[model samples]
Target: MSSRSVIIDNTDAQVQYSPGWQANGSPNEYKRTTSNTETQGASFTLKFVGTSVAVYGTLDIVTLPNTTYVLDGGNPFPFSGQPQSQIQYQQVFYTSPSLPYGEHTLVGSCVDGGGRVILDYFVVEIPLEIPTNTSLSTPTSAVPTTLGSKPTPPTTAIVGGVLGGLLFLMTILVAYLWYRQFRDPGRRRDTKPSFTSAEQDAQTRPFNAPAMASSSYITTQHDAETPNHYSETPRHRDVISTVERHKSPHVSLQWNQSQQPPSYSM
Candidate 1:
C-alpha cells in the first residue's frame, strides 16, 4: 500500500496523558514526566492508524531520563533520553519498525527517574485512501462502452438503399416516356414543320422580314384572267418589233412558271 506522512504536535488532543505527566518548559520544550518525588507511573499513550510511528522530544544531558514505548500492546522499545555534549530540542527518542497498515496503540512511560523525559511530537506514516492493487482493476468493459457508444447506424447500407429507390423511379419515368412516343403514332411528330413562303424566303434570302406578295383574304375588283403564252397580242408585237426590220444581238429569252425568268434582250 502507498503511504503518507503526518506531523502530530504534543499538545494535540490525540495524545492521552496520565496523572503524573505535565507540560514542561515552553510548549516548544514539550511535555515531561513529573511527580512530587518520583517520575515512575507517569506515561502518555496515543492511538493512530498508520504503517509506523516515531516519537520526538527534548532531553537534558546531565541526567538522562529513562523511558520506553510499547506498540499495539506488544514488546517495549526504548524511548530514553540519551546524554549529549550539547543541548538539543526536538530529537527522535524512539522509532518503530514497519508495521501492518492499520490502527495501533503506542504508550510512552518513565522507566526510571534519572531525569525528566520530554515529549515533543510524533511522526506517523499512514496508508493512502486506496491500495495500489485495488485501484488497478480491469477497465476493458468501460472503455468500449465509452468510445464505441451505441452501435453506429448501418450508414453505408441506408445510403445504398436510397440511391436504389431513386434509380428505380428514374427507370419507370424513362419507360413511360418511351411508351408515349411509340404507342400512339399521333403523339409522335415525324413530319418536319411546314413554313409559309414568306418565312421560307426570309430564311433562304437572308432578308429582314420580307413584304408578303399578296393577301388571299383581300377582294379583287376585276375577274382573274389566264394568259396564252404562245399567242401574239398587241403588247407582244410592240415588244417583238418588226422581225424584218432588224435582228439585234440576242441574249436568248427564257421563262419558267415556277422559277425566275432569265435575263433577255430584245
Candidate 2:
C-alpha cells in the first residue's frame, strides 16, 4: 500500500501542530487536550488517487469502545454531465460521535462511482499534548525615567518673579516717604500774624497829623498870597479848599465856616 500525504492548513485553523510521527502526513497527529480534559470534536481533510476500476470502500472511525462506518460503498458522483476518470478529485466529511477521552483513528478508502474501491488503505490519528511545570525568574533593576517624571519649575520664571518683587517694594517705599514729607508740620511754611491793639493805635495817630498839617499849610499860603484880593473876591478860600479835599481820600483839607455857606445850601 502507498502512503498518502496530508496537508494541514494552519492558515484557517490558527494553531501550531507538531510534525507527524510514522507516515510523514498520513493521518497527521496532534495533541488536542490533556487526560483530564479530552477534546470532543475535531475536523480535518484527506486526499487520494483512484483509477476507473475502483468503485466503493469503507472509512473507519475507530474509538476505544467500538468502530463506526459511514458509507459501505461509493455512488455515482456526477461531474458536469458524466462521471470523471481515475484522475478526478473527491472529498468527504466525517466526524466521530462523541468518542471516549482517549486516542482515536480515522481510516479512509477511496472508490469509483460504480461501487469499486480504488484506494488500498488510509489512516489518521490525533493525539493529546501533555504540559510540564516550570518557573520563571526576573531580575530586579532600575528603569529609565520618563520626561514627565519629577518636573522642575523653569529658571526664567523664578528670576522674573524675584525681579518683580524687588520692583514692587521699591515703588512702595518711595510713595510712603513722599506722603510722610508732604504731611509733616516741620516742612510747612508759616503765615503772617494778626495785628495787636498797640499797632492799630500807632497807624491812626499818623492819620490825624497828616490832616492838620495839610489844612494849615493851605490856609497860610492862601492868605499870604491874596490878602487884598480876598476882601474883594466873591468866592472865599474855604470853598476852594473844601472842593479840593473832596476830590480824593488821600488829600487832607479843613475849612472854617465863619462865613455863611453858599446861597444854594446855607
Candidate 3:
C-alpha cells in the first residue's frame, strides 16, 4: 500500500512522496509526503517492503488557461487535468505484498469531446512486496558548527585499491597454477614415468628398421669350421662344401689303391 509520486509543471519539478524510503514493508514505516507549487515537473520512486518491488512515476501539469487536476490508481497510476485541459500526462507504479511477483500498468485518461471522462490507455499490474523490519530512528549526533564535514570518497578509494590489489594477486596465483599444470607439465604430474629394463634397452638401442627387415627375409648362414658362430652370407657354406667334396674323392681313390696292393698278395 506504499506509494511514491512526483509533481511536475512546465519549468518546476519535485518528488511528492516515497513510501519505501524507510522501513519498507513494516507497518511502522511511513512515507513522507511532499508538495510542490512550482511550475515544473518532478519524479518519484517507490519500493514496497524491503524487496525490489519498485514503482516510479512522473507528473506534469497540462498547460491550460485554467484547470484542476486529479490522479488515478491501478497498475501504473493515471491522472487527468481539469475538463478545460484536454491533454495531460502522468506515470505511476503498483506494488503487492508477499511472493516474488509483480506487474506494471500504464493507464491514462482524458476528457472526451462529449465532456465525459474517457479512458485513454490503462494496464494492470501486481507487484511483489517483500517483508521488511522497521529500523529504529536514532538521532544523529549534532555536527560541530565550526568543523567541516569529512569526505568519505578517499576511504572508498583506498578500499577499492586494496580490493584491486587482492584481485591482481589472485589472478597471478591462478596463472601460476595454470602454468605449472600445462607449461611445466613434469612438475605438475608429480610422479616420474618409470622405464622397465626391456623398455630401457629398447630405447637405448639404435633402430635399424631396414636392416631388421632385410635380416628377416634373407637366409641365415653358419660357418662350417665353427658351427657355434654365425656368418653373413651363403658363400661361407659353398666354400666349405666345395673343399670337403674334393678332399673326399681324393681320399677314397687312395684307399682303393692301397686295397689293390693287398689283393695282389692274396
lDDT of 2 by residue, 93-178 (tens): 23233322232323332222223221211222211221123122111121122212221223676799999999999999999989
Q: Estimate each model's TM-score.
A: 0.44, 0.20, 0.19
Identify the runs in model 1 with alpha carbons over 4 angstroms from their true place: 27-38, 132-266
lDDT by residue for model 1 (80-180), tens: 55578976766778888998666678998887774677677677776556455433322111111121122222367779999999999999999998998
Ranking by lDDT: 1, 2, 3
Using TM-score as the yardstick, the better of models 2 and 3 is: 2
Each model's lDDT comes to: 0.59, 0.33, 0.30
lDDT of 3 by residue, 84-201 (tens): 3333322222333333323211122222222222111111122223234433221122111111111111255678999999999999999999988786666444366566867989
Ranking by TM-score: 1, 2, 3
lDDT of 3 at 85: 31
Name the Cα RMSD for model 3.
18.8
RMSD of 2: 29.5
